[model samples]
Target: MRDNAFWIILQRLRTPLIVIVVTYAIAILGMVLIPGLDDKGNVYHLSFFDAFYFISYTASTIGFGETPYDFTYPQRLWVVVCIYLTAIGWFYTISAVISIISDKTLKKEMIKGRFVRQVQNFKSDFIIVLGYNRVNSEIIKRIRKANIDVVLVDHNADIINLFQLEESSMGVPVMVEDALLTSTLKDAGVNSPYCNAVISHFYKEEKNLRITILIRFLNPKVKVITRATLHDTIIAISDTDIAKVENPFEIFAKRFEIALTAPHILILENWIYKNADLADKASYLPEGRYIICGYGRLGKLIKEKLDKHGMDYIIIDENNVGTDEMIKNETFICANADDRDVLLKAGIESAVVLVAGTQNDIDNMSLFITAKKLNPDLYVISRVNTMKEISIFEKSDINWLFMIEKILINKTSLQISQPLKHSFLKRVLYKDEEWGTSLVNLLKAQLGDNPQLLHLTINEEKAFAIYHVLKANKPIGLNILLKSLANWQNYHKAIPLFLKRNGDEFLLPSNELLEIGDEILFACDAESREEIELIASNIYDLHYVQTGEEKRNWLLSKVISLL
Candidate 1:
């Protein structure tokens, strides 16, 4: 598809076709005024000016004017021929006009040409968005909000053009071409001192990884943010030229993290959509001595959050990158997270959390096991793709594991709770399909096959608290549990909803406090907890304390009283 050249010529011909029509329009009206056609076969004499007028009039042939002359048979034949030619040409011109106005081809081709030409005019200080999607648009908007110049790229030319036109006022240039192509990449100004890192696609994690690698090869100094669909891509792109969004698997972890830490950020859009405002809180930092084992997409986001909060952390990956730049506070250990020595070297014992969010599924599992071995207490948070992997990890002693399948399931089910036509959720969730095919919504709809009802809340410990319902359990308890939250929360601040329940019945949502079956995802601020507790009725005593010796034991002990 990339090599196809057939359409290029057709695209270039649009301008010439327009010129032909404009010239023909002027000539058509005059042709009909000539004294040419006679009643018989012989020719009727007419002046050159009259001939021209007649031809022009004939060409325009609106039937608005009287005949200029009675013509012989041959002259009449000539007039008929001229009328036919004029009418056919006018229709042809109309068809061409419609094609130009309606078809995407001409516009896209022109935009691409303009983008290519605009590349040479580019100076430094530009950001590159290497895929097209709502996420990309949001990312661009964020970058632009910061007043940074960005050049957007994607396979879809029309989308890029739309961005260009919409952002024309902003003066951001967009290039409609593949980010992987060297020529196109060059047009993106990847190496110019002004060029920042390249942003990868949201869903096309694999492609993002490849593009980042290419970008790195093109210009190692340029910072690149890549994406990977699974955990292993993190490991693969660890030392490559880009940071990771951490694909679908890690995305679930990040989303769940946002839910636990900042549910307000998670809410809205009928599902969890990443908003810049909450991104900082959602990042994994704040408490010092944290370790991000894989600095891919998820890790990058986490890293940024940490930075924004002025927290300390280290990045560990097989590929050595940005090690020299990190220095004391921001350490980069070029080794596997699975290594016991590496874990210890990264202060695993003292580290608050270990994000095992590599793009590879197997790597995440292995990383979790190895991390567990090194620091049994480390909050080894990881991501998984398949539903089957959930039980294995859950039973494997991982206290803070977030599975993508369940998240996708939870989100999708929430969206399609009712039938397609009868669903308010579907209307909101699929309003524009603008978020792209959210796997969360799709998996939820598929619950009829393997029904599971899961909800989430936060607890005092700050570690995610979860409960599940198997097929054996009745669905009625969920709503009752939510209703009785006040009963459960007299002793606890965080309320846990059914974090993950495996059953066919739909779960009830409550404005109550924590309940017995509640899985609480904690928020960072007391205010967030206070807000959550307002609706929660029955809250049970689930203790949450900082690790080892508390920083301010007495201060934390009086959390509820202080509230």
Candidate 2:
């Protein structure tokens, strides 16, 4: 692509360059052949060098007066012709240059060339985001906060331009091109070892699937994170190795179920994702008759979960055409859910839960407000279609809100930026409610509400001090990392949430002996995380934390002995 840009410039300006060269050659030749007279009236011809130099300034309209003598009649006549010839040639060349500069194809190639260079020169890890929108913009912001670079590719020039206009301290390189093309991905550096992951969250499942297959073939090691809402699409995407598929409907349904059966588990998961504070108490969903508005994909998924729990519910959608026979016959009302008559038909007055699951934000908000007017005690859950109206929904004080954009952003960012933490959260979903509650209590007790999740590997790169000590056959336990440097007797406000060694997993393994290749995930505050890093990388700090006394270096030890 970089070479393409260079070639494009040459190709576009080829004729203009030829014209300029020929014009200069003709002008210089005329000057050398024509006769001129010096002050002494000696007839002489200008040298090739002087002719070339005179034409150089004359063609540019600099008009450094005539050089080295006065011209004879024929010489003056030829000079006039040369002046206009060069001026016309220069004008044509300048116009051609301007035309090429304004050409869209050339501009795209230049931008792409610059983008390719940026990706090639990238030193740190980066993720390539396929499309851009409010969701992706938010994802990029969060990813940047973690000090990771993000490259964006979008087909819409307007969206790309809008994003570029935003006030971002760290500029994100963007390419305005079709993301579905293999060439686009290649230019984005899908094969680069530094390219950590590729994110494709297109609305079309087929596009995402194609991207996953392309990335797999191009670089099987690069993790692919994408979105797919359908079961078949999800299964197809899952077949590719290291592909993290996010189904917003499925995720929301599972979360809704957790809120019903295990509120604490939902709370814990939210805290881990930084969606909620650990100090915030869990609000359990009431189990009773429910009213679900809209019968779209999201609505149907919510209905499936409700049926799984064997809960009584009614679905009210404006259009019930092409819906399943069972749904049409069973507690489904064919009317606008926001209408008072529809609410009464759906038994909203007696329903304990009302889900405004429409794809439209305004309709969902209307349904919730109307339902709440009838039944003030209704536990309302609404689906927010766009982020623009989020403030309106928040101001309405809906009990539980589901924003598909937010769900996708959180899930995709978590999986890409923090794979280990992503894995831990996935395992957390399968654990029993009792286990979740205990973990939540533990996190709150030790790391407080906003503890940062840190993943550490005992290797030469990540933990030099600890790796060397383990290599030298020195025994170090997980407890050593939790000890404070100030006082080894007191532990830091951190906990070992998970440990991995030799394909075995241990949860909350305290006082366990550390190995050279052990991977550990800790939940701790910022201060504790820094302390842990110091202990892992600095030998003296590790020694101080391990032993009560600070270990001195060779020079310090000799000076102390002499003293």
Candidate 3:
């Protein structure tokens, strides 16, 4: 790509360069061939060097006063011709150069070349995001805050320009190109070993699938996190192990289910993702009749979950074109959900839950307000289509708000950047209420309201001290890891949330012996996390934490032995 940019420059300037050379050569040749007179008034012809020097000044309009001597008529006439000839050639060349500089194709190639170089020079891991919108911009902000580099690909020049104009300390490379092309992916460093993952949360399912497919062939090892709304598209993406598909509607539905059945699990998820503090009281759904408005994708998913629990519910949509066969019994209403008549028809006055699940934000708000007017005690869940009207929704009387963009951004970012936390949350969502309550209480007591998640792998690169000790056949239990570096008897306020050893996972693993290749995920305060890192990586700290005796240096040991 770099070579291509250089070749483009050379190709564009080929004619201009030739014209300039020809004009200079012709001007110099004319000066030498024409006869001239020296101060002695003798028939003397200017040498090659002298003629070239004279023409250099004359053509440039410098006019060094007819170098050597006064020129004859023919010599002067040729000089007149040379002035216009050289000037015209210079003007033509300058215009051509300006045109090349302004060429959109050349500019794109140059930018691409620079982007490729930047991606190549990346020393740490980075993620390639496909689009640059409100959702992706937020995702980029979160990912960059974790100190990971990001490469963005979008076809909209205005959007790219807006991104560039934003004040950001982290350097993000943006490429304006079609993300569906193979070259675009290759240029975005999909094949780079440092490339951690590629994120494609495009609105179109086809684009996301195409990006996933291209990345699979480009770099099979790099993880591909993409979005798919359609069930068939999700199934197609599932065919590859390298791709992780995210459906915001499905995720929201499952979360709603968890909130209804096990609110503690939802609390744990919120705490882990930093969405809510542990100090906040847990909010759960009421078990009663539900009136769901709009039978779109999100509405359908919500209905499926409600049906799974055998809950009584009725769907109110503007039209019931394809829902006749699916919805038995006159439970489906063909009327606008925002209308007062529709709310009364759906028995909103007696319903315990009302979901404004339409595709329009205004309609959802109107529906919720009218439902509240009918039954202020009803628990309302509103779906937000865009972030522009978020303030309106927040101010409204909706009990639970779910925005598709936020759901997609948060889920996709967490899955790509913090895989361990993501995995832990997925497992926690399926656990029973009792188990979730116990775990949540444990975490809150130990780590406080908000805890930082830390991932550690016992290897030469991550935990040198632990790795060497385990390699020497020395056993290290989980309790030793939890011990504070300052005092062996005092333990750090940290708890292991998940542990992986030899392809097996143990949640909340107790004081079991840890091997060299074990991976542990811990939730603790920032200070405790830092202490844990020191204990695992520093030999002296590890020794102190384990045996209450600090390990001495070689020089001190030698002196003690001598004494």
lDDT of each: 0.53, 0.87, 0.86
Q: Which stretches of candidate 3 lie over 4 Å from their true place?
A: 1-5, 38-42, 68-70, 321-328, 557-563
Candidate with top TM-score is 3
| lDDT, residue 19, model 2 | 98
Give the per-residue lDDT of model 3 (tens digit) for 82-125.
99998999899989989999998888888988999999999999
Off by over 4 Å in 2: 35-44, 62-70, 321-330, 447-452, 486-490, 501-504
How many clashing pairs does model 1 include? Answer: 81
Instruction: Pick the winner on TM-score between candidates 1 and 2.
Output: 2
Query: What CA RMSD would candidate 3 show?
Result: 2.5
TM-score of each: 0.36, 0.91, 0.93
Model 2, position 390, has a per-residue lDDT of: 94
Put the candidates in lDDT order, highest first: 2, 3, 1
Regions more than 4 Å wrong, model 1: 1-49, 62-77, 96-104, 114-124, 132-139, 156-177, 187-194, 201-563
Tens digits of lDDT, candidate 1, 1-563: 33223465455556656655655544443343434545665545565566666666567765434345555555666667667666776677677767665657666666666665565466646667776665565556655664667777777757866776665326666766667788788766776777756666545567767776787788888766654556676777776735534344445545544533443333322232221222122232235567887876567677776666566788898863654567544478878777888888888878877788776778888877777777676776776655556667767766566555444433322222212211322222322222322322332343211222222333333212212212223232322322212343333322221132222212222433323333432211343244344433212211111112213457567996778
Best by lDDT: 2
